[model samples]
Target: MQPGKILVAEQDGAFVIKLVGEVRLTLCTTMDDFFDDMLTSKGFASVVIDLVDATNIDSTTLGLLAKLAIKAKQRFSYVPVILSTNPDITRVLDSMGFDRVFCIRQEPVVDDEDLNELPVLPDSEDAVRAKVLEAHRVLMGMNDSNRAKFRELVTLLEGQCY
Candidate 1:
């Protein structure tokens, strides 16, 4: 069973967790432990999940994540951001009514009007840098062919910067 890997970084006052590798039935416990620890902590204004490196993900992980979102909503101070790209999983979450619950959206593929939809939290430059850097890192980690596409997106973002 592969351990569910979560790498945490801070952007603005928000915590960004990158979920990489295979997130399936085998790794549910690991993920559960990670979230439980986070849920008990304090300080983060929001949590962003970057699924750029997730090659496989199952329903179990999705359900747990959705529950996290619901729980976060109970707190007046913060919320958890969920990032996903797998078409199959995305569709399933949307069909199950989780799309609205967790703010599930497609993984940004190219630089375009859609990139604007990302949560930049303009008040925090640090958060902007973190998200941009994370996206770039994810792109760099991709296969040689996909790297160019991400680079283009970065450049597009640069031009759109206000």
Candidate 2:
């Protein structure tokens, strides 16, 4: 499968992220960097995640989305919205406890025509590892099921930390 791409844009104090194709581990660093920059910027008010074109998304990507929701609420006092038209993807999101942090809508996102693809940043081994570990940790915090599912991998990643 082809790697996923993230398209991003800012509109009237809100940021939008559109995920396309297969979203997996390789996009974690880029997502993490974008999250950092978006969350830190002044006057940032809200965020929307458009998953209409996403064919598949992995656990790491789910974790990063979770992180986005959590941070958005904590930092900006707004719950991030996730627009997904695919039932399968919506099912996956529901199963992963996304409803707790995001406003999951079974509809298309608005004003997506102006978004531009975020360039995939070159990855460093340490940066990728850190992003992966952080994403999984955020996932584990969602519920007991997630914690149980990711505990071993978290331990393994922790061990690899120097």
- Against the true structure, whose lDDT is highest? 2
Give the runs in model 1 whose Cα sits over 4 Å from its true position: 1-4, 11-13, 77-79, 107-162
Error of 1 at 56 (Å): 2.0
lDDT of 1 by residue, 1-162 (tens): 544455566545465666667665454454555566666767647776667667666545655666566667776345555666777656655655554456665664232222211121123444443345433434334345435545666566555553
Model 2: weakest 10-residue lDDT segment is 106-115
Task: State model 2's lDDT.
Answer: 0.90
What would you estimate as the lDDT of candidate 1? 0.55
The regions of model 2 sitting more than 4 angstroms off are none
lDDT of 2 by residue, 1-162 (tens): 767999999976788899999998898988888998999998898888999999999988999999988998887778999999999999989988999999999889756789999988889888788888988999999998899999999999988876
How far out, in Å, is residue 47 in model 2?
Answer: 0.8
**Model 1 alpha-carbon miss at residue 78, Å:** 4.3
